[model samples]
Structures are given as C-alpha cells and as structure tokens.
Target chain A: MKQRTEERMDQDLAFLLRYENIAWYEDGVVKILDRRIYPIRVEHVICKTYAEVAEAIRQMVTQSEGPYIAAAMGMVLAVQEVKDRTKETILAQSDEAAYALSHARPTTSRQMQAVVNDARQVIRDALAEGCFGQALVEAVHAYALHYLNEKYQRYTRIGQRMEELLPQRATILTQCFPGTIVGTMLRACRQKGKEVILYCAETRPYFQGARLTASVACDMGADVTVISDNMPAYVLMNKDVDVFLSASDVITRDGHVINKIGTFQIALAARYSNVPYYVTGTPDPQHRDTSQIVIEERDPRLVTESMGQKITMEGVKGYYPAFDITPPEFVSGVVTEKGVLSPYELDRYFDE
Target chain B: MKQRTEERMDQDLAFLLRYENIAWYEDGVVKILDRRIYPIRVEHVICKTYAEVAEAIRQMVTQSEGPYIAAAMGMVLAVQEVKDRTKETILAQSDEAAYALSHARPTTSRQMQAVVNDARQVIRDALAEGCFGQALVEAVHAYALHYLNEKYQRYTRIGQRMEELLPQRATILTQCFPGTIVGTMLRACRQKGKEVILYCAETRPYFQGARLTASVACDMGADVTVISDNMPAYVLMNKDVDVFLSASDVITRDGHVINKIGTFQIALAARYSNVPYYVTGTPDPQHRDTSQIVIEERDPRLVTESMGQKITMEGVKGYYPAFDITPPEFVSGVVTEKGVLSPYELDRYFDE
Candidate 1:
C-alpha cells in the first residue's frame, strides 16, 4: 500500500521536480540539468569525475536543493573512480571529494556538507563489511539512490502539510526558485481541487525565479505570474495575497530565515500588511544564530550585466550578496516534514 | 552677485545634470538625451515637432525632471511652427501642443501640465503685447530658457537644504534616478569637504538607477556602488547606511509619496532599521490622498526580458507596475525648496 502511494506521488510531480530529471548517476557518469539555460533549452552538464561535478555546482549549473542532490551523486562518482584501489586509498580520496563539493558555495554549504558526509559514512560501512573494489562502488551508488528517494518522500509529506495550512483559495507571493517542494505543493492543491494564484519574484543576477520557478509552475498547470524582485511589496499591499511563502537556504536555530537577497524586504512588507510569512525548511542546529551563516557574495559582474550585455557604466562597481536574513519576528511559521511549527517553537522539530 | 553664484553652480554640475544636457531647444529642434542608453552611449533623440517631443516622452527617451523640460521645449516648437500664421491660429496650435505634452505620461502629468500651461500663458501675454511672427516665436523661446533656469535654481536650493539634513560624513542609499538634485547635493558635500558614500539600487524594468544615477554620481567624483534592487534591505541592515533618500513623482497633501515601484520597500526597511527616509520633491495639494494617485502598470514584457532577451519561459506573464506608494508614517520628512518639513506638517509650505 505504501509503495503504491509513493508511486502515485512520483507520477504527479512536474518534469523538473523529479529526482531523475534534476540529476542522475548512470554508466559511471553524472548528468546535471543545466538550470541557467533551462526552459529556453533543455541541456545537461556531463561530469565524468567528482571534481567536474564540484565545478558544475560552483558554476551554478543547478541551484537550490539541486546542489544537495548533485553533491551526493558526486560522491558516487568519487567511489566509481577508485573502485580498483585499496580501501584506505578510496576512503582518503572520497573524504577529499566531500570537502570540495561542500565548499562549492558557502550559503548552502550546511546542507551540502550533510549530504556528502552521509554518503561517506555509507561507503565506510560497506568497506568494513569486507566489500571491496566494484562491490563497494555499487554499495555507495545504491545508498545515493536511496538517499535521493528518501528526500523526495520527506518533501512530499511537507508539501501535503503546507497545502493543509493554506486556504481553499489562495493568492500566494513567493521569492526565488523554491525547487521541488513548491512543485509538489502545487500538485497537491490540484489534487484537492483548490484554486491558487502564484506570484513569483524574478530573482536577479540569476533569473532563477523567472526561469526555474515559473517554468515548473507553468508545467504543473498552475496560474502563475512573474514579477520583478522589487514588485513584492507593491503586490502585497495592492493585491489579495493570502500568504507569503519561500524556500530558505538555511533556517538558524534561533529561527532567523535566510534565503535570497530580496526575501527580507518581502517579509518586512508582509509583516507590516498583516500577511503571514512562511518558509519551508528544517532548522540547522549548527547555526545558533544568523551570525554564523556565511553569505556568499558572487561576482559583481553578474549583477552589472544581463546576458553578457553591460547594463551600467564600465567603472561603477556592483554589489551582489547572494542571500539575506529575515528575523524570527517576521516569520509566522516554518513548515517541516513533521508539521508546521511556530518560528519561536523550533525546538519541537527535534523532539522526536 | 546672485548671477555669479548661479553660474558657479552650473559649472559645478555633472554633464548629465546640466539643463542643456538633459533636453534643450536649438535650431528649431528639441534634442532629448536618450536615458534608455545613457552613459553606455551619449546620444540624443531629436524631435522636429511638438508631436515628436510628446511621443519621445511616451517612449521614455527622458525621465524624472527631464520630461518637464522636454515638454516646455515642445511648446517652443509649436510656437515657431505657427509664428507666420494668424494670432488665433498660433494660440490654438500652442494650446493643442500643451494638451498633448502633458498627457504624454500619466504619472508625471501634473508637472508636465503645469509646465506647458505656463508656456502657453507666456505666449498669450507675448501676443497680447503686439509681438508677432518671429518676434512672438522669440518671446516664447526666451520664456522657455528662463523657465529652465528657474527650475535648476529651485532644485539647487532643495539640494542645499538636503545637504544640511545629512550628516557630515555618511553613507546614503537611494533608488531610481534622482536627476539634478542628487548631483547638486553631492557637489555641496564636496564643497564642504564632507565624505559621502552613495549606494544606488539598480531599479529594474528600466534600470534608471544603474544606467542613469550611477553614471551621474560617478561623473561627480563621489564614492558610489551599484547594487541590484533586491540588495537594498540587506545593505540597510548590514552596512552603515545613515540615510535613505529618493525622488518622488508626486506627494499627496496627506503625505503619501508616489515614486518608483521599489521605493516603498526600501522605506519600510529603512524605518525598521531606524534609518531616516527623506524624499526630495514638492507636494501636490491637488492629491488629497493615495487614492488620487495613479500607479501606471507598464508592459509586462519589460519585466520579463532583460536587454531584449527573454529571461523566463514562453507563456508566462509578467506584472510591471511602474510605481508604488509609501505612506506618511514611513517617511521621515519631505525635502522641498522651502526647507525639510515633517510629513504631518506639510501645510507649513503654503503658510506664506
């Protein structure tokens, strides 16, 4: 009965929301869907080694939760490369690969580190059981596939919980590309015959919201409109926005939600207008407060130019801080797989 | 002595801030500096008739205070075209020109209407005084030049008053192209040997901040950095932003400010962070409240594309409202030619 239900949920997801479509390891190579040119053109960046996969993450070929999955597949590549070597050599090389993949981007490093560390532990257990050479590689590869499936299942449940918290008819405002969870939530809304209007803020310096989120929502047959990052406050004040939802890169233990650069401004406007703001993600106990979160400042040229065409003058510098922190006061709740928890009551998430 | 001081101020202005550089009437043609491709390429859109000038305004060849001057020059073109005809014909044509120029764009219609009306009134007086043909054309032409000079002088005073309110050494955050007023304020700071760091939000859909404001500020020798519109709240929170300044399209008698779409978000963030928000513009007694303000919804294609390239998937819609409103409670003060006054105390301006 559980297997049938899981298969039904998998069939309901949008094309880009599926695990195999985002990134997959097969035939000793990893292929990641290139998000930069997605929806315009369907393509993938082929990675023969774990180093190539790490480079792809740094280049932002895939973003949001896409990187976390790519990091796990990268560890599988690392195991495949040295399957004929001794166990000690394979473990040392895999540790190096894990470090490189986690350090690809600073803002999402916490999740990426967790994914790679779990993969390495699986490899260690398989080797201690007297599995050598190709058998050990097979063991890690199987572990990676299972890890991806478990994450998808967890998010599916979170999506159903999120849909329950929403109204029967809702006008939603969101920022950045929220990845699979939003797609699953939209699918859940359709399943229940609920009406939803989505407004997406076109995240700048990387048109992630415009390119990634809009495409997925459009494929799911949801009513969606793309807005520039600056329009969130205007839309919240003038339009009938039932809720402001977003996916966070990391939520600190103190309940500060950090996501894209524009999320904080939206949270402020949402709070002022009495609209509740909710973020979907689990809390990172490593970050006790926002002070520990490292915001990645990408290349200023990305902000200064659009499609390789310079928007501003030659000498004027551009500032592009990849993310911003929204204090707990602005957040109404954090939706987790367990349930919707209050921002101040995050400790409830770890009680189990 | 007053004339010498005015000349010194003109010399101190940046090239783009000068009246002639923005828009001017010469050789029976009105040349408007094309703001859409400014700083990247210094070019002008030539208007051979009043109709062409009005069309230029609609197309956004010039913006902010630039349109006010363009509308005045357009009236000059009308007078010259019919100077050889009957007085009745000339007056009729001038009135028609005034209506067309003012109605070019809705948001700034009040200012444009006042400018063209003032020009027509000057023509009525010139004709009544027996000035005819070339003499009548010359009379209206001279009025336009004097009117432009008076406006420059008025904004110069507003700039000086704004400088007085700012700290000696401070960091300032601004949105959209503030036009000549910001240029003059920076000059005033330089004259006083005060340090200032300016952060410009690269306002999207038009990039008025990136292409226009940053160019002008850099030319004036101020320390300036261009950031995407989404980065304002982050900068306000993390950086030492002492003041948040912007230029408004119109301010209602109830103290509501209507400006670029992103201004309200910045104001909300500024108020939250205890940074005073100041806007430079005269209040319109005509608008009783925000309900009287018309927020122009522009073409969605403008927001969906960047540099003529589509950023999102096909079939997805974009929402582009050119302006938003900031309530009086969020505003710290309104900087006018008279002085900086409390938002609630706007009636003090008309006391004289």
Candidate 2:
C-alpha cells in the first residue's frame, strides 16, 4: 500500500525535475541537470572526468542530495577513466576523485566525504583483492548503486516518520529549500490520507525554497505557500505552524544541526513562539562537536545578484554564508531512519 | 568640527545618487528620483496630480524618508492644482492628497499620514488666519520647509546619539539599510573620531539595504559590508557586532516597534548572542498599543524577481510582508533626539 502511494506521488509530481534522473554516470560520462535555471530551463552539465564533476558540484549544477548522488556517480566515472590501468593505479585515482568531490561544498564536506569515501573504500577493497579493469568498474558501479540505495532508504523512512508525527491535517513551517525532503514528506503524507499545508521560506541570495522546494510541493499537489525568509517570525507569531521541519546538512554528535543560512534564525523564531522545530537527517559520527563543522561562505556574486543580473549596488561587497548551525536544544526532534530522535539521541545514530 | 566632517562625507560619498535632491515640487510638477532603478540608472517620475504621486509611492519610485518628504511635496503639488480656487476647496483637495499618500505604504501608513496630515494642518491654520491666494501657497511652502527641517533635525539628533553609542572603533550590524540614518550616523561618528565598520543586511524582495543604505554608506567613506537579510544570526554569532541598529516605521505608545520585515528576526538573533539591539526613531503618539499598528503584505512580484529579472521558478507564489513588528522587549533601546531612550520609556516621549 505504501509503495503504491509512493509511485502515485511520483506520478503527480512529475512536472518537477527533482525526481527525474537528475544525475548519473553512463557510458564513461557524468551528466547533471543544471539546477541554476531549474523549472524554467532544463539544461544539463555533461562532465567526462572527475575534475569536471567536481566543478559541476562547485558550480551547483546539482546541490543537496543531487551532489551526494552525483559524487558517488563521479567515483564510478573515475573508475571508468582508469579502467585500463592496474589495480593500484585505479585505487589512487579513486581516492583522488573521492577527495575532490567531498570538498566541493564545505558545510556538507564531511557528510559528502563519507558518501564518496565509502564508495572509494569499496573500490580499494576490490583492488586489494586483486580485482582489475572491467571487474573493478563493476565494483565501482556497485558503490554508486549502494550510495543511491542508502539515500532512498533514508528518504523512505524520513517521510514515513514525518507523516506519523503529523495528524490527519497538518501545517508545516519549513526554511530554505532543503531540497526534496519536505516535498517527499508531504507526498508521503498525502498517501497516508494526510493533508499538508506547507509554508516555505523563499531563502534569499539563492531563492532555493521558491525555486526548488515550492516546485516539488506544488507539483505534488500539496497546498504550498512560499514566503520571504523574513516572514517566518510573522507567520509563527500569528498563524498555526504545526511543525517546523527542514533538512540538516550535518548534525554533530553534540546536536549541532547545520543547514541553510537562515535555518538558525527560523529555529530561534520557532523556539520563541513555542513551535516544535525539527531536522530530517541522521547525525554525522565524525564531527564530535560544532567546531568541527565548517559553515560555507559562498561567492558574493550570488548574494549581490540574481541569475547573473546585478541586483545590489556595485562595489558593495556581500557576505553569503551558505549555511548556519542550530544548537541542539532549539530543535524539537531530528527525524531519522529510526523515528523522531531527540537532539541528544543523535549519538545513537552512530550505533548502527 | 562636526560640520567639517559632515561636509567631507558629502564630498566623498557624492558618487551615490541617494545624497542628491531625490524629490521636489518644481514648477507645479512633483518630480521624484525613480528608486527602482537607483544606483544603476538615474531617472525621475513626474507626477502632476495626487493620484500620480500616490502611484509613484505605491510603485516605490520613492521610499523610506523619500516618501515621507515626497508626500509633503505632493501636497504642495495638490495646492498647485487649485491655486486659482478658494481656501476651502484647496483645503479639501489637500486632505484628499494626504489620505491618498498615507495609504501608499501601509506599514508606515500612520507615519506617512502624520507627514501629509501635519502639512495639511498647516494649511488649515493658514485658512483659519484668513489667509488665501498667494498667501495660502506661501503657507504650503512653509509646511514643506518645516517638514524638511524637522527630518534634518531628527537626523542630526539620531546621528549624534548614535555617535555617542559607539567606541572609537566598532563593528555595527544593521538591517534593511534604514535609509540616511546610518549614513548620517556614520558621518557623525567619523566626526567624533569613531571609525565604524557597518555590516548591512541586503534586505531581500526590495534590496533597500543593498541599493539605498549601502550605496550611501559606501559613498560616505565608511567601510561597509553588505550581507543578505538571512545572515544576521551568522554575523552576530562570531563577529564583534557592538550594536544592532535599524529605523522603525512606527513605534507604538505601548512600545511595539515596527520596521522592515526582517527586523524582529535580527533583534531575536541579537538578543540570543547578547548584542545590544537599538532602533533609531521617536515613538508614534497616535498608536496607543500594538493592535493599532498595521503590518503590510506586499506584492509577491517583488520577491519573485529582482532588477526586472525573474530569479525563482515560474508559478511559485511568494509572500512578502514589507514590514515586521519588533516587540518592545526585544529592543534594547530607542535612540531618540533627547538620548538613547529605553523601549519602555517611550511613554515619556508622549508626555513631552
């Protein structure tokens, strides 16, 4: 029944390119949907090498889960490039590819590192076992498939978990785009006969919420309203915001949940208004505390302009920190593969 | 000594069109510097009637103190329309002009109302004194002069008070650009040997902070860093933000201070980080409580695009409440003509 609902949700939301094959490695080439002009334009960045794939991630051709999935595919392409080489040389190239892809976006560097590195580990183990050429490339394909599978698994559980947290009818206040988490969650909720009203923040300097999240939510037929990031406090003050849910780039063992730039402000407003704020993700076991998490400062061109059109006064430099950290106490819960975990319960995520 | 520094700032920051005469009633036409294309293209809107002037204000051809000052100039234009008529008809036309201009920007409606109505009151007094014809037009001119002088006086006090608030070198966090207050304040601070590093929020949907505030600030020879409105919490988290100051649209008698949409979020972020939050303005005596203040819901087109370019996905709706109310408790102090007044001490303003 749940599987049928999921399939139907995808059908309804087909207008959004997010659910399509946005990133993949095929025939020794890496291709990604250029999300910079998403919905209005469907242009893809075709990459042939690891460096090209790295540049795609850096340029935000595909961001959030797209990068996570793309990096894994990038490793597969790296294997394809060195498929003619010896096992030792393939291992070296795979390691280099993994390192480059992970550092593409700094805030999610560690989490991304885990994805590419885990896939690289598989290639290394196969090489160590004397695997080479086409056999090693097949092993690389396995790693890409594994990464994609893990991502889907998390999405499956998270959407189901969130649907349970809500009643038959729910009003969700979410920040940034947070990519497809809210969209999938709302779609899954609808599958369960739950109605959702999503209030999204049109995350500034990027417009991710308006461009990305709203596309998926609206296309999926959920009731969605996009607001400027500034309006969160106003909505929380006067409206009935049932839950504040957003995706975390990285959540430390200490419960420092980092996401988009405005998430901290939204969480703070939620706390003040007595609204329950949530983050959808498992914690990163590597980062012991908040200090280990590096917040991303993007180029000023992004904040000072929109779609290459200069918006602000020229020569007025802008600081665009792409992400912010929300201290654990401010979070009501962290929706994970298991269930709604308390911020402190993030430590248990590593147990698996 | 203070006068010398002010003159120097005007000379240094002359590159920005903001410091020029932006609005004036010239030869029976209300000519306003078109703000939508500010700092990039210099253009003016020529309004020959009250409706045209009101539409200019509605389209944000002039904003902040520009509308406040321009609305007064608009009334003078209304008087020009009926210059050949009796005092009673001119007075009636002026009231109609005042009402039209006040509703142009709702969040600042009362504040704008006060500017136009105060000028109308001057016209009423002139009529009561048995003044008419050229004499009434002369009285209308006096009203415009009185308004310009009052705005300048408030600016002098605000800048002077802000000058006292800072140390020799301080990093100040500001929001929505808040107009020439920061420009004049930084100028006065420089005169007092206080070098300030201003971190401005590029208030989204309108880009006022970036286009208006930062233009004046950078031109004035002050070191300015423009950050997005999404960034206050991040800036306050690690940066040495000595103060968070913004201008209020209205400060109620009960102390609810309304300003740009993101002010409350910034204030909350400031409070969380223990940074002193201050608003530069005197309270409105007409609004007895928070209930009296009206929050504005602006057109979504402003948020969906910038500089005539569509930045977000098509078909995605946007909510832009041009202003947000910062409760008195969130405000640390109100920098006024007298001194830095406590938020609760606004009642003393009414007493005077």
Candidate 3:
C-alpha cells in the first residue's frame, strides 16, 4: 500500500524516537534522512552495536534525522543488549556511543543531543519509578519508542495546523534540506491528497538540492525541477512560485536564520515577487540562542576548485561566501521540532 | 613587401580618415567592414557614391572608420569617376547619402560622421584649388585618398610608439572590438614582428569579441583566445596576462573612456595583478567636450534575457550592463587618431 502523507509524517517522527528491533522488517521503505529514495525501497542494513551504528552515519548510509536518529536508537538498543550491569560501565558506553555517532556527519546537533538526553532521562526515570534490571531496560526502550511516536503525532498536528495557513496546490521553491520537519508537514499535506509542485535550487559549493532535497520531494511524489543558483532570481521573476521553503543549519533564539549566502538574494527576489518564504530548524537549549550561534567559514579555495571525481585546475581566483543571515521580518514562518512557529513568534518557540 | 611599423601606422591612420572607394582606388584593394555580418549577410556591398557610402556605413555594412573610412574614400573616387559636370549631382547625392547612413546603427556615430565630413571637405578643397570639372573631381579624389593614407600613417606611428611602450611576447587581455583602433595598434606591433598572445573577452548583448574581434585578430594572424566575460577576472587573477587593452565607445573631452560594463572590473583585476590597462578611441568633436557629450544607455533586457538559443519556461532574470565608465586614472594611456594620449593630456586630445 502507498504510504499517505500523514503516514509518512508519522513514520518519520516515530522512526526518529524509536529504538527496538521488530520482526516485521521492510525494505525499500521510506526513511527520514535520505528522503530522495524512500518508500520505494525498505532495505535495512542491520547493525549489532553503537559503534556499528556510528559507522553507518559516518559513511552517510542513513542520512536525515528520521533515519539517523532511528539508527541511533538502534545503537542504544544494541548497547543495552550487551551492556554491563554496573551504572559506571553503562554511562561510559552511552557517552562513547553519543560522541561517536554525533560526529559522524555535520548534522543538526540537536538530534543527537536530544536522543542522548532522552536515553539518560529514561534510565533516571526508570530508576525513579522503581524499575530495575531487565524491567528498567524494557521500560526505557518502550518510553523511547513512545516518545518517537509522540513526536510524529506532534508533526501531524503541526502539518494540519499549517494547512490552514497554506492555500491548496501551492507552488514552492526550496533551498537546501528542509529536514523531516517540513517533510512531515508535506507528508501531512499529501495524506490529505493536496497537490504541490516544488522548484528546487541546485545549491552550490555543495549541491544539497541536487543531491538531497530534490530526491526527497521526488520520493514524496511532489513535482520537482532542479536548477542552478544563478537561475533562481530569473525564475522567481518570471514564474509564479507562491511559496519559498528552506531548512536552516542554525536558528538563533531571537528567530534569525543562518542559511546559504545566496539565500538572502533569493529572499530578496521572493520579496520583490511577493512570495512567502519559510525556514525550519529543531530548537534546543544546547543549540544556542541567537547570540552564541556561529556561522561556518569554509576555505575560499573551495570556490575555485572544481569538485568532480578528480580535481581539475581552474586558473582564476574565486570568492565563496557560505552563509547569509535572513532578517526575521523577511521570513514568513519558522518551523521547529516543537511546532511550525510564525516568524514573529520567537518568544513562543523558545519560551521553554 | 613587408610594411614597416611606421608605414603601417601611417596607412592605418590614412585609412581611418577618408571615404572608402577613393581609398580603395588609391590603394588598389577594398577594405572590408566585417562587423556588417550581423542580422544577416546581405549584398557583398560596396560603396561607389557618397550617398551609397554613407548608407552602407549607416547600415554598418562598412564598420570601423580605420578601414571603412578608407573604403569610403574609394566611394568618393567612384563618384568622381562619373561625368565631370555631374560633380554637383555627386555633392548633393553625398549629403543625402550621409544623412540616410547616419540612421543605420545606434552608438559609435564617429565613423559615418567622419565620412560625410571628409567627403564635403575634399569637395570644398578641390573647388578652392582652382580645379574645375574633371580636374576638380580628380583633385578631390586624389586629395581624399592622400588624406586617408596620411591618417593611416599617423595612426600607424602612434601604434608603433605604443608598441615600444609594451613588452614584446606579452600576454594581453582586451575588451570589446579594438580592431580599428587599438587593434590596429597591435597590428602595428606585429608589423614590427612582436609576439603577443591576446585573451579577448566575449562582450555580451552583442558578441563583439566572439563574432567580430576574435575573427579579425585571427584573420590578421594574431594569437588569440576568446573567453566569456564571466571568465576573465578569475583568469587574470590566476593567469599571467601581462597587459589589458580596451577600446571605448565614447571619450569625453575630460578624458573619461566609457566602454562595456565589465571593462571596469577587468581594469580592477588588471590593477590588482599589477598589469597595465590601456583605452583607445578616436577623439572627435561629436564625442564632444565633456560638457556636451552624452553616454548612451543600451537595453537592460539584454541582461534580463537568456543568452542561449533554447528558451526555458522557468528561470530567473539576468542583469546586463552594456557600458561602464573607467576613470582616466585607471588607464595607463589612451590611443587616439593623433597619438597615444596619457590621461593628463585630456586638454590636448580635445581643446574644448
């Protein structure tokens, strides 16, 4: 059976929070991180330990939070299966698992932080509830899985609420990866059987659109066309792209989003064309409120150097600015793990 | 016989000054205006009457005064070849011819203006020398040819002197069609047997470098590479191009040279690389003293439109700025009809 949009959103969120192995395993099925080729294939590369799970993520075998965290949860379950009885041994193993898995890729640190925090919380909560040994382990596993499902339910609620904010069959232009947050939202729309067409930007330096997001939309069965960054302003000027949606690597507490450099120009064009633009990111205290957030400065040589199977020499100096900060005023809305927050509702999103 | 740099400069300058047919009769060969290959290649058009000459010029069938003016000289001679008593008819025909020719192309009005002015002057000079009828026609034709040849000689001298200023075997990056101007300057150096490799920019909106200048340089046996304008700054920043040469469409009496937009950027890069930049143009009264000169704005849609042959239904707008003004300070020297003028010699190039 084809997974409806609501089903995908539920699956993504549930997958993000769950850790137990199930007898009913599916291959060529949908996963969160690598959205491009999901549902069509549900093949699972099972690993027996946390180290093994870290290796999968380091190799980018499992990509987005939905799959990545799901894989992380599997690692936690693997640790529990072979873990020592003593608290010190378990704590040490948990730290090792979290550090190894977190550094596997440049990811939303919040995902790993949240999962590790939850694992620790489950242990404490189980002990406080007078659960111990095998019972404690069973309770923790069940709680982790339940939390994952709860996040999925929240996504559905958010997606349903956002539907009222969006028109039927809206045309959207997306930059970078929108994560499972917007994916869930879109999935929710799909469950309702809404039609949408996505114009994807072939984001440069790293072709996130070409490599990641385009396929995610494609997997979700949204109409998608990938174009170069230089072509966006022209497209925005001529085509009737109604909405602009993008994922943010960093969002400050005050609601400022730091995204790709050309994103600002795209936002400028969208503003000129009267298109609504949105940015989404997961929020956590460790992820720094607005002031402590730092933008990444990459090597300028990356711009001049061509990235192909083999390196080629280009006889010109190139200037590459990686990130641009979009003013909150220009943003239409902000989506978070908690909910889809309005650009003006920073206080609400970060209130906790 | 191999022409010396001095003789070539003189011939080129003389070619710039006179109408083509007379110049052709005196030199025994027609100088072709290759720029007329635009829109379509129509008649293997030649000018025999001043009216026909101006119209050909107005139509840009004859382009670039350095050569077309010589051809126009030939046309004046052709008119003279007609019945001696019909000289009055030729004179009348020439004015009407010039007026019609002036409307052919937009911008760069100097070439046609030179033709009309020289034809009328030759007529007046002939009538003044007590020459009448056939003698008057012959006198006018001979005088026009001599005038053209002398102008070419003077320009050749300027080119020769400019050659000494540049190193032999240098790599040069140049903007726009300097063929009749600094292009002739480089040809003068070739007459001296200097080796130079030219990196020519593909000036857009009109692919002047790709279509006109590159072919001219190649035809004249200059070592040349045509690259798009987008590629130059990087190439210059990394590649060891020794010099930059650009020709301006307008030079105000104050000495600012206005040429293609990216010229300024090219100049900036050349300066950063410690390479000398040169601007060349004919210093004419109609180019006007600074107070009266007007810089024409080319279409901006050229920037907004797609350059490739195939059209896509979706894409963003592009920006195309036709010309940019280069401050005299950034230019090492300006080559004109008379001599190579330094920025400080603005008063000398024009005495307005």
Judged by DockQ, which candidate is best? Answer: 1
**Stronger candidate by DockQ (1 vs 2):** 1
lDDT (Cα, tens digit) per residue for candidate 1, span B256-336: 899999999999999988999999998887777777677888889998898678887877889999999999999999999
> Least accurate stretch of 10 residues (summed lDDT) in model 2 chain B?
B1-10
lDDT of 2 by residue, B1-352 (tens): 1333333223322343333455666677778887777667767888898778888988889777788878888888778788779877887899889999888877778778878888888888888888877667767866775666567667767888888889899898888757667767876887788888888887877777777777777777777788877789999998889999898888887778888888999999999999999898888878888886677777877777766667556556667777888888889989888888888878886565
Q: In model 1, what is the error at residue A255, expressed in angstroms? A: 1.1
lDDT of 1 at A202: 88
Candidates in order: C-alpha RMSD to true structure? 2.2, 3.7, 12.9
Which residue window of length 10 is worst by lDDT in model 3 chain B?
A: B305-314
Query: Which prediction has the highest TM-score against the true structure?
Result: 1
TM-score of 3: 0.48
Give a tens-digit lDDT track for model 2, residues A192-290: 999888888878776777777777777777777787777898888877889898988888888888888889999999999999998898788888898
Worst 10 residues of 2 chain A by lDDT: A1-10
What lDDT score goes with residue A88 in model 1?
89
- Interface RMSD over true interface Cα atoms for each candidate: 1.0, 1.6, 10.8
User: Can you tell me which runs of candidate 3 are displaced by over 4 Å?
Assistant: A1-3, A6-352, B1-31, B36-43, B48-52, B66-71, B74-90, B101-106, B110-115, B128-140, B180-194, B219-222, B285-291, B296-323, B336-340, B349-352
